[model samples]
Target chain A: MFHIYCPYCEEHREEEEFHPKGQAHIARPEEPEACSDEEWGDYLFFRDNPRGIHHELWVHAVGCRKFFNITRHTVSYAILETYKMGELPRFTAEFPEGSLSEKVTTEAEAMSRQEGVKA
Target chain B: MSNLVAQNIRTFETHPGVEISAESPLVFFHQRSGAPAPCTESRVALRERALLGHLILRGGAIVLDEAVHSVLGFGLPAYPNALSRDEGGERSIQWLSPDEWLLIVPGGEEFGLEGKLREALGDAHYAIVNVSGGQTLLELEGEAARELLMKSTPYDVHPDNFPVGKGVTTVFAKANLILRRPTETRWELVLRRSFADYLYRWILDAGEAYAIGVEV
Candidate 1:
């Protein structure tokens, strides 16, 4: 079984403490009444089934019972990083080949971008 | 009923005021399976701390900490997987999640404590759930107690991983319980009332080789 680092607990806990909750960052439509039937159906039922880098939502069911996101390599089963909700991931499909240092740089850039938008 | 209706939050005392026969969760197990008497040869000992007050506190840490400190004279455990106890050790608060904590106090004191906490935290977004009858605390001691736990849970029970004051809710055998280390030689299992018998049986079955006993 895989050991996962729970972002809230700040520790590596056994896999049994966590439950995989499909894809991460799927936002519900703000105006569902305005959307077409097909668009509504897509929002409700459609999810990415990718073989490479995947972002997943997981709940630490037994430990902290908090929901968080995991950026993982599906094929390699390597958890590149784990982050809390409302936080952006450093390693996405765009930076799939990014090294640890590259991830740090991008993470800083993402933080600055968020601040820029806020400002 | 009118007073309760006027209040936004509901709180109840599980313990009856009149003296009534109360059975611990392990009563059936102790009766049928029979507990071994603690002896010098016994490497592990188990005892149930029954009928204690179990309160689940849910709120922001700062607010809860302020109320707890004012009422209970202690603050909540600041770190995750940590437990903080009063100087006497009879009262304790264990961190369950970011917004949740478990406060356990001596029997017969919970109702008043809940009222005091509610008064201390007026109009704050918080909840206090009294769950005294729903669960019981079982204390395991002796040298082999840790070994008995290792056999049951996937959690790393080694002292290096589970140092004193660390507690976690984890799988125990096929069930779930809160495992905690209160002292160097003692471990506590907060077992649900329903699964206490099964867990007791599992512990006995696993600890047979170690000559485990029960201290009445």
Candidate 2:
């Protein structure tokens, strides 16, 4: 079984504690009404099945119960990296080593998204 | 249900009066399967810390932490998957996620605690959900307790990996529960009421070799 690393939990947990949530970084159109039918449909249904490097969304269902992104090799089945939501992936298709300019998610900025929001 | 409304949230006491009785999820299991009493040769002992007030706090940890610290007189666990306990050890807070923490206290204190936390958090982006009736805590102790846990969960239970004061929600015998090491000799399993029977049986079966006992 794959011992996947959960970005939120900050530890590697058993695969049974997690579930793959399809492709990652699929942003919802900022204004849905302005989008064309094809754009909306593609956003709703289409997903990439890249054979090489792929970024996927996954939830640590049983552990932290948090959603995070995972960059993995689809063919080799090796996990390249795990990152929390709202943060960009380092080992994308182009930059295998990592990108120099990545947004540093601070504790305050992360908490700002939660302000005034009731859960 | 109490008509007390705090911060537009309805609050009620699960334990209102002495007339209404409370039972652990294992009550049925004990009736059907029968809990074997601990003997001199028993190397494992199981005890249910039933009806503890369990709260799931969600939001920015900083806001929740301050509220919790003010209300409970203790702050949230400093790191992920860590457990922080009160001086008496009767109360604990476990870091479940970056934005979430699980607070467990004495059985009847939940209602009051929720009110205090809500009062402290006024308009802050936070949620304090009292999930007291949904789950229960089972504690395992003795020599073979680690062996019983090893058979059930894939997570490394060695002291090096899971030291004292660390708690994690993890898979156990096909089910998921909060696994915690509160102290060196004790391991706490916070099981959902729905999964308690199956896990109880699984623990009993796995611990049979070491002669496990149940303290009803």
Per-candidate DockQ values are 0.71, 0.82
- Candidate 1 segments whose C-alpha is farther than 4 A from its true place: A98-119, B1-6
lDDT of 1 by residue, B76-185 (tens): 99899999999999999999888999999998899999988888888788888998889999999999998899899999999899999999998899989999998899
Q: Pick the candidate with the highest DockQ.
A: 2
Candidate 1 interface RMSD after superposing interface residues? 1.0
Candidate 1 C-alpha lDDT tens digits along A11-85: 898898789999997878879999999999999999998988999999988878889999999899899999887
Clash counts for the predictions, in order: 0, 0
Model 2 Cα shift for residue B88 (angstroms)? 1.1
Error of 1 at B42 (Å): 0.3
Question: What lDDT score is found at residue B185 in candidate 1?
Answer: 95
Candidate 2, what DockQ?
A: 0.82
Which regions of candidate 2 fall more than 4 Å away from where they truly are?
A: A101-119, B1-7
lDDT per residue as tens, model 2, B100-210: 899999998998888888788877888888888889999999989998999999999999999999999999998889999999999999999999999989998998998
